[model samples]
Target: MTQSGEVTTLKGESTDQIFNLKREASIYYSDSLSTFNDIKSAFIKSAGNSSLQMVFLLKGKLNGYLTGSKKACLTFAEQQHNILLINEKLQLQIKTETHEAIFIRIDPAFLSMYIPADHLGYLNLKDGMQKNEPALFSGCNLHMTSEIAAILNALRTSEHTGFCGKLFLESKILELLVLQLSQFELRKDDPAVRQLKEEELDKMHEVKEFLMNNMNQQFSLRSLAHMVGTNEFNLKRDFKLAFGTTVFGYLTDYKMTLAKRMLIEKDVTIAEVSEKTGYKYATHFSSAFKKYFGYLPNKIKSGKLSLLILIEDFSVVFENFVTMIP
Candidate 1:
């Protein structure tokens, strides 16, 4: 078994020698973030175990199932969280084109330092899975809030190294802990809300993928619900539970983020970018862009020195995650 904080590679056979593939897994540990990068061309399973782990999927999609069990395939989407209570029955078949995530491994004793006296019981229950015979794994699909996204993006893109960079990274990790705990508190009381079944979650993911792929096309909740074989109410409820944003809210943020990328990276005109991102009118697109990004699209195109300087300045402090999947 490969040790933690090291790389593991496996080569598999194929009909054409050129088509054979090698998969690599590496873990990087620090005081705050433990980043895991897995690049694979075929299926793979865990050879080593871990302590109680909180995994945040930052990029790519992965589907897997436990070995020697009848449970269905589990889908892990980008911007989601998975809580795994590690144990022997935790063998998994994780397969993806490429997978990258951040895993925070914690022991209950150490974690208690971060919890308040009032919340100790809650943390205890969550940590209780470690004592169970079979490992327990729970997952929640959360919308990447703009705050968390900004910090993550900065962390991913920063060029800084040494003690200063490490300090910045650790602060962001603590911010995520606060945000995640707050979000958890918001939902933990809603026992009336049903937890989505595996198939239901899969269908919701399909709905999300569809919306993302068709960003230029307009979609109504009713139409989307029908496309995903669900009713509108359940669709809205589950999407919010899984993604932490209303359907239209998520779509708008997505469109605006895409628009920013095009404005910065592509040589396309404002009208062209607008049409490409689903706005029929440039004025409407400009207004939405301003609202979302605090600057008009023309400011980006006309090379307004002040706004451009502002963006560059912010990039130093808060560059958004450039690797976000469109």
Candidate 2:
């Protein structure tokens, strides 16, 4: 469903044939899901023109074709990489033949709120530094690697609830942008050499926290930079470095964090909480949770810890033993 060159414009869901990605904040938090089938069989068949989009693979390999005819298959395997396709938006045909995946597709307008909007169209997704850009996630054509994963995990504790969730999520996204650029650097060109001054980096952190708590409303990095009196690009750079993530990553993670907590604390059924978490389906959450936490929710709450995952997370649990001498 894509034309693949110069300009993309998807003003809104144009066809019933396409699955409308459910972004929760829009309904003003007053509306609950119309149904639990939000995440399944989501086929964006024959995508109309779009401005640009960001797709993150949560599981499986998705063969994405630019148009109805499969010119070449885009192999996305459990990675998050943003691509700026130049088109007046074209027909994009998406299908999960290998394994069903959950994708968070965002409009350029929504994305522009955080960074230099020009970079969205300027950055190249395909030409990366990694030779041949390995297709399988195991290979490295894509990132969302465990390294970024570690940084992300630590940033989101149970405390921030509403605020911290947003900050960490944005930080994670910025980190993701850098990682993707690094892959491009590994292949074609070197990434831009711009490091935020130490002080600006400090404020970038504050900006993220502000956005996190207020993501539902409109925002702009330029205005934010001015208010902070820093360059937008610098703020973006430091924001990324300090958080070790990105604006988008922070948003997605923040949403998922709520989903996780709700599942754990609110005692909501997985189906209900999935929608609340911005997931259209529960299967996606199940897969993501198992991958992220090494266990499903029941396993986590059951007090049944895996010997393997436990060792991975807490070596002391396996090595240290206490005994009473009688």
Q: What would the TM-scores of all predictions be? A: 0.57, 0.33
Task: Summarize candidate 1's per-residue lDDT along 80-172 as a digit string, tens digits.
Answer: 765445445444333443455555443444345455645633354355454543232333444455455555554444444444443444444
User: What is the per-residue lDDT of model 2 for residues 246-323, given as tens digits with 9 covering 90 to 100?
Assistant: 656665566655655555456567777666655567798778777765567666445443333323433322222111
Q: What is the Cα root-mean-square deviation between model 2 and the actual structure?
A: 21.5
**How much is 136 displaced in model 2, in angstroms?**
17
The whole-model lDDT of each prediction reads 0.54, 0.42
Q: Weakest 10 consecutive residues, lDDT, candidate 2? A: 23-32
Error of 2 at 146 (Å): 0.8
Runs of candidate 2 with Cα error greater than 4 angstroms are: 1-51, 77-102, 106-141, 151-161, 190-326
Q: How many backbone clashes are present in model 1?
A: 3
Best of the candidates, lDDT: 1
Instruction: Compare the candidates by TM-score and give the number of the best one.
Output: 1
In model 2, the Cα lDDT at residue 193 comes to 36
